[model samples]
Target: MIDKVFPTPDEALHDVFDGATIMFGGFVTAGTPTNLILALQRRGTKGITGIANNIGLGDKLDVLCEQRQLAKMIATFAIRASGARQSLFEEQYRRGEVELELVPQGTFVERIRAAGAGIGGFLTRTGLGTLVQEGKQIVNVDGVDYLLEKPLRADFALIKAFKADRLGNLVYRGAGRNFNPAMATAADVVIAEVEHLVETGELDPETIGTPGVYVDRVVQCEPVPVRWYG
Candidate 1:
């Protein structure tokens, strides 16, 4: 089999096209593929639909929004985390220039999981009787009504991990593990960036969060400086 490792982040993302749907693995920027995102911003691909926990907290996804590279965002949290400071995504959304799909966190991840599992959709009451329920089909099961949330698959998935074997098995650190595994399975192409690249047998089989089967490409990237007591 051909090696899954790539020499650089841009090369890993070389096949990503304009108007592609992408899932970014990160929660509050802790496990984001910042380098790959930077390369993507430089690539100038437009009309991108991004699926992530948020637009970012002054991090990776925000820069993409500033460039207007992202045409739409399907996320649990968007600009609300910024408090008084609005992100570029919010500005574009306010002007009716970008499409936004605000989903509850649980439902958002569940939708992606459904896609990966080959399930049509799932029923959830998370957004019941709220604006989030709009346009969604409601089904009553056992006398309880729930809204149908469609699966959320993507064309490309950009994931981050602390360590990876040459074969692409991944090991995420702490909170960095949040969305990477699920996103990996939900995309047609998954490129994982790792801080540590080791031989194929280095990673303990049981500790690998994402197996090589789900990763198409792997690249080594500079590690993010973590602040523990901020």
Candidate 2:
């Protein structure tokens, strides 16, 4: 018999070490794995390189920034458009305490998908003729320039889901599905924090966003109110 369910978030993340690259699945607070993030915060691992769509923006990930646990961030949005809502990540970035890699949102998701698909790299015109192309290889095809973007992979992926079975198949809800399925496929060890845990075969096959094969562990957590600011 195969079982991927874990009793707690901390146990599911026990193997995560210092200086590991991690993928965080979410768009702002939607689908964010707050329980797993909280567990990681409690574990106190440092020098993490986190890949996410946004660093803070009301997500619980800011606590990692406040704790100085992150060494670098590879994200699409790390700073707010207005200065009024400054995140700890932005403050650390401005102070030069942490490194930041600003990737275009489309490119970010594609890169992660490429990793799961086992592609070396891809060429795209998304960043051509801009600072985004700086330090990146550019290839010309038929007089058109395209920047080469490499795949993004991680040691661990922390994702959220609406429901998960003991076997680890995942079903997501609404905007909460954002990034969770893709991140589940792109990491070596994928841990899902779910609102409900059911027996195997409880989830409809058609509704499954992430297959059990891609998930290493599942942890059930209560639905918490989304916190937009710390």
Candidate 3:
């Protein structure tokens, strides 16, 4: 039985270094690993590359971009109407201080999962009709255009969950079940931050979103402060 538990978010994320590539779990405000994200920001490590579904949701991840700790961002979208205000992201992109790699939401998840599974790459028709196909190998499968998309692996995966056991089995609550599971599988090291921490076997087997095998560390997150994006 592995303890795999940490009292603080900072401890769970202690070994993250500068210039590392990280995959953050979330789909906007839902299931975002905010505690670990904040700890990373507070660490002030620079030149980081992050992959997530989106980059805003009130006070959530916007802080990272504002501090310039991020060197590049790969995601589907940056919040324009809501969340942490994409002003920082837009400013950085325009100045060329930060690079952005836009990806389709579904493809992003698949790429990460493929990386985790040790697969080289897979073909997809998601970007067949647009610029997403540019610079990528194209193949015809059953007379349909498919683009070759590479797997996405990360040095660290920051995942959030509604609950977890000391052994690192995770259970996500409702909308929080978006990208956290896939991100968890795709990282060399997985750090999980949960709102509620329980003893081993406390969580039902069927309810676990991510198994302990993928998780390396666990942290109990404190209540997040409320911030309005509107």
Over 4 Å off, model 2? none
Give the backbone clash total of model 1. Answer: 0
- Candidate 2 global CA lDDT score: 0.91
The reply for model 1, stretches above 4 Å from the true place, is: 224-230
Question: Which residue pairs in candidate 3 have backbone atoms (N, alpha carbon, C) closer than 3 angstroms, thus clashing?
Answer: 58-83
What CA RMSD would candidate 2 show?
1.5
Q: Report every candidate's CA lDDT.
A: 0.87, 0.91, 0.84
Q: How does candidate 1 score on lDDT?
A: 0.87
**Candidate number achieving the greatest lDDT relative to the actual structure:** 2
* Candidate with the greatest TM-score versus the true structure: 2
- Any residue pairs clashing in model 2, and if so which? 58-228
- Can you give the lDDT of residue 170 in candidate 1? 94
Candidate 3 lDDT trough over 10 residues, lowest sum: 78-87
User: Candidate 3's residue-wise lDDT over 1-230, tens digit each?
Assistant: 68999988888888899999998887766778888888998888888998887775543776888689888899888636444445677677878888889998888988988998889888898988798888999988889878999999999999889898989999999988888898889989999889999999778998898999999999988758545444
TM-score of each: 0.94, 0.96, 0.93
